[model samples]
Target chain A: MQNTALLTVENLCVEIPTRRGILKPVDDVSLQIAPGEILGVVGESGAGKSMTGNAVIGLLDPPAHISGGQVLLNGKRVDNLPREQMRRVRGKQIGMVFQDPLTSLNPLLPIGDQLVETIQEHLPVSQREARDRAVAALDEVGIPAASSRIDSYPHEFSGGMRQRVVIALALCAEPDLVIADEPTTALDVSVQAQIISLLKKLCRERGTGVMLVTHDMGVIAEASDRVAVMYAGRLAEIGPVRQVLTDPQHPYTAGLMGSTPGASLGRRRLNQIPGTMPGLNAVPDGCAYHPRCPRAEAKCRAEPRPPVSGSASCWFPGEVKI
Target chain B: MSALVKIAGLTRIFDVSKPWLNRLLERRPKAFLKAVSDVDLQIEERTVYALVGESGSGKSTIGKVVVGLLAPSEGSVEIEGVDLHRETDAAKVDHVRSDIQMIFQSPFASLNPRWKVRDIIAEPVAARGGDTKGLSERLLEQVGLAAGDADKFPHEFSGGQRQRICIARALASNPKLIVCDEPTSALDVSVQAQVLNLMSDLQEDLGLTYLFITHDLTVVQHMADTVGVLYLGRLVEEAPRDALFERARHPYTQMLFEAAPRIDAFGREVDPPKGEIPDPINPPSGCAFHPRCPLAIERCTRERPEMRQLGPARVACHMAEP
Candidate 1:
């Protein structure tokens, strides 16, 4: 707690008491983001990437509760922060920009107004001062005509611009950490690049540690300092970005990388993992990815603990090669 | 080479967003949003031509028009030299349509929930006056699905399998040209790779020409022989896959490349792709992308640049020569 890791999650677990029984979407998971560094949490849909983000922000829907573990922001326990305290911490200390900029932004309000309101809420700044700060934030993100476009509504702006506005809103308060959950997923490839660049640029300039969650491996490789691969709500692998992506130790992580169309072509086709993600309600008895893992054996049937080698969960991760 | 498909100046204007009450009260201006604007492209026999753009960029609209879902306002659509909407007879229309088929985005929605996979795949064959004997078993196997999968409901199958059933249905018609509109975007990345690989394999076996439409650059990299970039109802750049990837001339294209997170390069700060694509109804004067262009010149503000050949790429940008 005394160390300045910026944010740390230790064996975080959340449960939903459904009609059937207690179900866990995010199992025992632990990760960290250092000050000014970027941590990428990646997985497919229902892999708990968004769930983890939502849990961190206290925005989890009803019936969902943080059952066990601890979350530390700035070395302070934040798992059970009160609603009012959490609300204050949300925009001031840890900002968020969602996947769809259009939905995240209030389409009825002008972009400038939204940013100004966001800035003024956390800080005791007048509308004029907030507007000035908004323009400055927009400019910092490389948006053109920061002065004029500020007055335009979200509909008037393009997808990339709208995302920039969301970024400006998130950063105008100058938070210590920004949780961008699939920030560029909704934009075009070229525009997706711009938003990713802008997010990385601002985080770098302001020394804002970022928790970037996305499904794209390319984004993780390009933007993240560290990478965490989640499977069935658990962290299958976590390491240096290049180490985890290029030479994955965990079979789940390796399968994910192999499944990507652009990664390798000598195999002729994606090395398919035999099956799809299991339904969230049915928890696997042992290694969650055993169904799709190619190298699974009898040992895989026994519930495996988190691998000690470079932070992975596996039954037979013999040695740390990297 | 005999082209399998040809699109010349394809344009479709839709007046959405105007309510009935608003239209009755005041003389509401006919808001024409050019969903698919002027464009020229050719699909060579058995080759895949990919059109890539974000939502509202008219890539899907063009697919819709090609499949006669919507008729183009100002351009012509030809399938093997037969026009879709000529003042011609029904025999010609039937003949033209028989050679063209389309695969939709969501397999869950596209494949009826109540129907078994066998009936779903056989519907197109029944419609197109094709043989249905042993079709389901063969097509299912081709897509890597078991023959027993044909007896199950769509809900029983995974997304990838459901999409395979959709592919089987599309194949039922045995079209020379298939317009695939973001077919894999709704599935997981791993599943997407499987489906894409399957599509490529199917193409190879059937000698099918694919007009693959997607916003994901990775998918384009895997499936496209030629790539076209669209922005606000216009085709901004067209080039061979490698040429487009290596030598994109359009500022928007350049920005797009920079914005997308890539796999090989990790841990670098990226900028926003480019400015947002403007509204097609009231697009920016001169170049549609001028307002957001990082290298916008004076010429970009005054007159719209026509698509011109530069190097091996065809680009619509005043900055192309530079």
Candidate 2:
């Protein structure tokens, strides 16, 4: 599976050292994305979904560094590249779309200038050629009157339009992989659908591998080919999207689906997991999820489950009582 | 059981104009943004009524108006047939006011960081010179939090726990109507389920009426007894939750339902919703949604549709089928 993958993350770990103790935010996480495929990484706020993405893109902030494992791009290790070299690899071979469009953009520069600068920096294109390509990129993302809107400030565009501009900027370099972390979480539903379709179309047309990180299961069902469910900095389940959504194996995964209001219908009450996810410093022994897992046993609490060798990392996978 | 809350012809217009000097310099007139326009809805006792729309669609504005945080520029809001805004009796108004409470979207920002959880939850009753002894601890336990947590600060709690604190505060006064403006939007799926389930159980126990405002269709479907679909401040469709989800009437409502990502809709290709929401300041001439309506016609663009009955729904669309 890794041989044909465009991006493969093998046992990646990210740790942040605090005064009290060391925090492992991303622990032994592994997944892959093939050309034209989207693999969704979903978890709660502290589940380390974004940390894994940041680690893969070499954007992990200081104090939180990749402590172990390798991130390979097209079978070539990119995790160990130097700062300057990795900077080049980021824009030239990988693109990123963050949760907030406003933060991702430069307030002072017209969008056109930003796009042109990025294209010229990575693609050996002339200024005029880059300008034309910028217009094309904006137009392709469904921005109306792309030529005129290119010069507009980020504030001038509405929330949805700003997100489209962000998507355009991410794709201007035509990277082989795109990591969109909560790309549409900030937009309205109608606009969110537009952005989702646009991302799918653009990636498929370019055969760009996409790692979409979001907490919304609906987005995962709509866009991803495969889905990875994370819990307390560990991979709980990973499989085809349909299989995971319909028959989630891990207790955590099943509880997540059951708790989400709209995942299913006609229930008088949501099947809520009893406890909050354990904090990084206090992650329980054996299984990180055993504290909240309905199927947890003495074995689960005493020792960690083996690394994910199948669809789920659970001693009692698929045995959760509804 | 009668209507616990009734809103009639609610309209709120905000002055979003440039300063007087700037307007004079720019040769412009004062501008107004109609946040909510001629809306009417009622919540039966012990039921949930959800107002759902895009960000600029004025769902939050309506929630604010209903909760008495914002006065309506036109129309009236009544709780149990007593108009709180226009009641001549001060004592009567105060009594009505004490029955309504609001829970905001962001639990972090809404809470006072400096205050302990006990004080935060007891403020509603304490401010009224009512008994607050053991109130915070009891409510905390009721919301599924430890009674001991009342002495801790808000920062010590996780996002879900903070939301539970917010819920405890909202329940402090034993309010009949709680305006939840995206209360669970800031939470993870499992945590959201926990909070939502708690809210449902509380309503059943206390006979609470919830004015639930959110942009999440799935959440609305799961929590709302009745659903109102808004577009550019206008209520486009109002129906029972199951009726609207099973067969949406208005084009915009249908579009919203289609655009929402569904767990059952894996691998389904939804036609992206057409066009962005029009600017609220300078809305289109007639129906606000005509610009994006797939079935829009000349009449739709020229005349605003009025809400009319159509098979268990009130739809405001020229093209809605009977």
Residue A28 alpha-carbon offset, candidate 1, angstroms = 1.0
| Candidate 1 Cα errors over 4 Å, as ranges | A106-121, A124-156, A265-267, A306-308, A318-322, B15-29, B128-134, B249-252, B270-274, B284-322
| CA-based DockQ, model 2 | 0.86
- In model 2, the runs with Cα more than 4 Å from the true position are none
Best by DockQ: 2
Q: What local lDDT score does residue A103 receive in model 1, on the 0 to 100 scale?
A: 90
lDDT (10s digit) by residue, model 2, range B1-322: 7998888999999999999999999999999999999998888988899999988889999998888889999999999788878989998988988999999999999999999999999999999999999999999999999999988999999898899999999999989999999999988888888889899999999989999999998889889999999999999999999999889989999898889888778877889988888889999988999888889999988899999999999999988986
Residue-level lDDT tens digits of model 1 in B251-275: 8777767666678887766554434
Candidate closest to the true structure, highest TM-score: 2
lDDT of 2 by residue, A3-122 (tens): 899999999999999999999999999888999999999999899999999999999999999999999999999999999999999978999999999999999999999999999999
